[model samples]
Target chain A: MTSSGGLRGYFVRSENARGFSLLAPTLILLVLMMVIPIIMLVARSFWTQSGMIETADFSLVNYQMFFEKKIYLYVLGKSLLISGSVTFATLILAYPAAYFVAFRVKKNKLIWLILITVPFWTSYLLRVFAWKLMLGYNGVVNSGLIGIGIIDEPLGFLLHNVNAVVLTLAHAWAAFAILPIYVSLEKIDKSLLEAAADLGEGPIRSFLRVTLPLSMPGVIAASLLVFIPTVGDYVTPKLVGGSSGIMIGNLVTNMFGRGNNWPMGSAIAVMMMISITLVVCIYLWLISQVKKRSN
Target chain B: MTTVAIDIRGVSKVYNPGSNQAVQALDTVSLTINDNEFFTLLGPSGCGKTTLLRLIAGFEQVTGGEIMLFDEEIENLEPSQRPVNTVFQHYALFPHMTVAQNVAFGLERLKKPQAEIDATVERVLSLVKMKELGDRRPNQLSGGQQQRVALARALAPSPKVLLLDEPLSALDLKLRQNMREELKQLQRETGITFVFVTHDQEEALAMSDRIAVMSNGEVQQIGAPTDIYEHPVNRFVADFIGDTNFLDGEITSVNDDLVTCRVGSESLFEAANSGNHSVGDQVTLFLRPEKITLSAAGDASRQGRVANIVYLGNQAAYTVDMGDGIELTAQARPREDGNLPFATNDTISVDYSARALRVLAK
Candidate 1:
């Protein structure tokens, strides 16, 4: 049994090696692309930068500076608020569309789903600029409103604000939000809805009590997909957000690019990631506890 | 002295009306279910029994005609506004709610007090023998347990009528039999009219006080189980309910209460006159297996050879072939010594009374 061929058999016959080898390609790519970059960022966050060069010595001065200057904290809080609002708005808009496709459309639902993702086939930046064109003072919306005689002058409040960023980002992430919600809603048994109606609940009450609760997993997935990425988005704000609408992402970009405070930028990025993770975990825990209590 | 709980008058439902794919799911069906009566709609699949039940439940709108509950027209009312609850097929228990919540849902929607809701939920759960599992989810229960919860949920609201849409088809045979008895008892105890729908004739005969046999979206007969079993109106009903042997004949004489018919080419048999035939009319005679008796004596009514024998547990079925190629099936209980009256290939004679034969128009 101790032959030379046994060496080749070791990897082929071993269950653990087979499993590990199957996953090795993805694991290596993930380590190089994601894990290694994250580790380096975390390491660089603790280093201090002198002039234009980074020092090897570890210090907490960047965090101290962040605390001393209240703008970073305000900007972070504002970014979180903006992302939260965008998540809520996007879900509210996507839910009815997804529900219509999932329950009301009896034939060719795949076509509707494809139509929803048609915007994604184009470049995301192009769509964001398209939103800019629509929300501009002399854009289609203002012209249509003026042509309809509803307004005599173009509205200046339509662009370069937090509202513009929320609107644009919600439109940009519509496809992401709708698909998961659609999948979850599709998984619910239609008989359950009929049972609800037979139990004396009106359509509205049935929706609140049965339909909404059953489709929550999809809602949670959609929220996470939109919320996490939107929090760190810099382009949307840079194009639509003016001086008063500057967010934490803009400050981080300035620190890394023109400000040349790489360590401070890394520290802010790390803090933002940790805070987002903490909020998501707390939300998940809260939902679980709520479900337990109801049960 | 009971009033009608539900009266369906000329109800019809047509799906995709006026389109190329249109289908008539139901056609002008009429029924009147008395209060506290256990009524069943028995038919094969796609025969519109479930469609009629849904019409009563207001899940589907009838294309024509009115449905009245307790003499009040409810055909146009919404399901939530109607005074009826359904124990759906497959026991559609809400997956997210506990048993107590599922039971309390209807009562809560009716705006009952919290104390009353809790009390009714507990009481109904106990009625279905699911009191101990009130805190468990639907996914955590067995099929029978889930069915009980569904019944308890429907019964908790104390609706005027309960619609059961093949609620026991998912259970094993033993559980289904047990639930059948329990359901009859529950219906009697609660005094609520139950409209059960199933395709099983045996289940219908065992459970219903009165049954309506349907075929191709039309009601063939509606009467007591014995009445329907003893006297099916047409060939479809006669063939659908139980096994029967048919013999083609021509009526030679039609008297007051008796009709003499020439069977096949030579034999003669008299059937009780149903007043629907005349002299020289072509007719089909329906005879049940148990009614035809096999005797070995040569002096019997008609002579035949035993072609085959089927050994049933308590009875034996013999297929007798009379001369002139006439075949008849007769069933007989085994004697005390476990012996059949006649064996295969033995010579025997078959005879049946005049009342055992049913003559239907061809």
Candidate 2:
């Protein structure tokens, strides 16, 4: 029975072929939902507007508009700065909390993680609106401050500003930052920490040398999860942000909704995607370089 | 220059306070390790051997009792503050570090000079025979190489005591055997007191200067390998250390030096230097398998039939069924002539001297 190697090999190949055929439908659906739209967006970026159909007059006019317009440049720069700040702040704040959750809190871990994720279950619009109310001129924050007698008057700079956008975005995306970092921290073997301790590292030294370096993957993941989405978010900026808080996402929305320029919107969307992709690639490359050097 | 390296007294640990289901991991364990001796805690799983090691390492606190290292009270010290290092079961080499960096990590933490740290790392790496592989990451090395790197890292700081928690359990059988000798040599060369924990009896017997056989959160016996093998305190220790043939019987006659026990119908057995026992007392006689010899012709002493024959490479082991239905094993070296002296279903005489059996009081 074991002598039929040729037949067995053919059977295995056919079985793998059957498996691939079974996966064809999901692959087709993914291509339709994700790949097709990306290709269409890139194609639309090179075209001129012609009512409902795109004209064949391909030019660098959209690219020139993006670089030449000072408003677009300012918004793009602000968006990058805000997203970068949020990423750094989230990483710094989330790391210790994640380390505690992973190594210190040995009991009720799932319960605590669920509690961390509870804010995300509520409607995003409602949460943003609540932030708006809290940051308003006569909102609860200003009222509480005045009641406490710390600030004599309501600070009008609290709402409709870049600070509000950053604060609200940080609050909104905290769970995103915490979960990945917590997972990465959790995946570190306890024996590794014990080994570090055995090697004469105090708790602080162990954290800096072992825990911090090992959790860089999670930090990068959390950074991308927050920064990539926040760079293109318009809701928080529109609600809590005044004229000074306009971001690249707001411009992209305006070009698509009120500006009635789908080609320009697609061009801006492509640019944003390219910039974020480039930044993420550079970050990953730098991290890999550091890892290589350490090893 | 032999000084007391570690002095542990009345150490016990209980997890989950105020609960009836609490687990007593360690129970008032006390032992003093000499400065340069290799002491091993040998026991089965859940026997509190690892717990005792961890308590001495200051990774776990004792509920009651004290531990002294280098004649100083260190029971309350954190693991980092203790003058000890541990080689974990998995080696736990920092995946982010090269072999040289991992070895130098402890020295760097001690704030040693760069020249000294480099020299010590190189010396220790060379001691472990891993100097050439310093640039390789832990994942790039084999299991034995990684284990050596871990040992180098642990010893680079010149800790007072090196605690090993089943460091060889993860290696393959051949590598484990090879590393065992390397570990012993390393300990001897470094002159650091080593407290090793292992469940493998062979490993414990081979490496330890003194083996503490533990069971049920308590030390059953602590002695040299030969003493532990020849004289076990209880049935658990006797059975755990090696294979032993036990015969349950009643002591018919007892004296200061010897005891005559009635093993079966019409069979009288003499045990030499048997422990304190009274007449008509129920007792058990323990005999090692290799001590008994099998002869084809019935001897006047003990008689049985060959029930089974197992031909090992260097020796032949036979299970003889006595007339009373008790099966006993007798081992003999295979002769070079290949002449078979014993066969299945053949009547055989199982003979052993009075000194071969150890009489244990019930």
- Tell me which residue pairs clash in candidate 2: none
lDDT of 1 by residue, A1-295 (tens): 5776887688888999889899999999999999999999888888999898899688998889888889988999999999999999999999999999999999999999999999999998899899888989999899999999999999999889999999998999988899999999999988888888888888999999999999999999999999999999999899987776677889889989999998999999998998899889998999999988887
User: In model 1, what lDDT does residue B154 have?
Assistant: 93
Model 1 vs truth, CA RMSD:
2.5
TM-score of 2: 0.94
lDDT of 1 by residue, B1-362 (tens): 88999998998999999999999999999989999999999999999999999988888999998899999999778988888999999888888899999999888877778999999999999999999999999999999999999999999989999999999999999999999999999999999999999998988999999999999999989999998899898888888898898888999999999999998678888999999788999999999998887777579867888899999979988888887768898897888888887788898878888888989878
TM-score of 1: 0.94
Task: Name model 2 segments beyond 4 Å from true.
Answer: A1-23, A48-56, B298-300, B337-340
Q: Considering every candidate listed, which one attains the maximal DockQ?
A: 1
Q: What is the C-alpha lDDT of each candidate?
A: 0.91, 0.88
Superposed Cα deviation of residue B338, candidate 2 (Å):
4.2
Enumerate residue pairs that collide in model 1: none
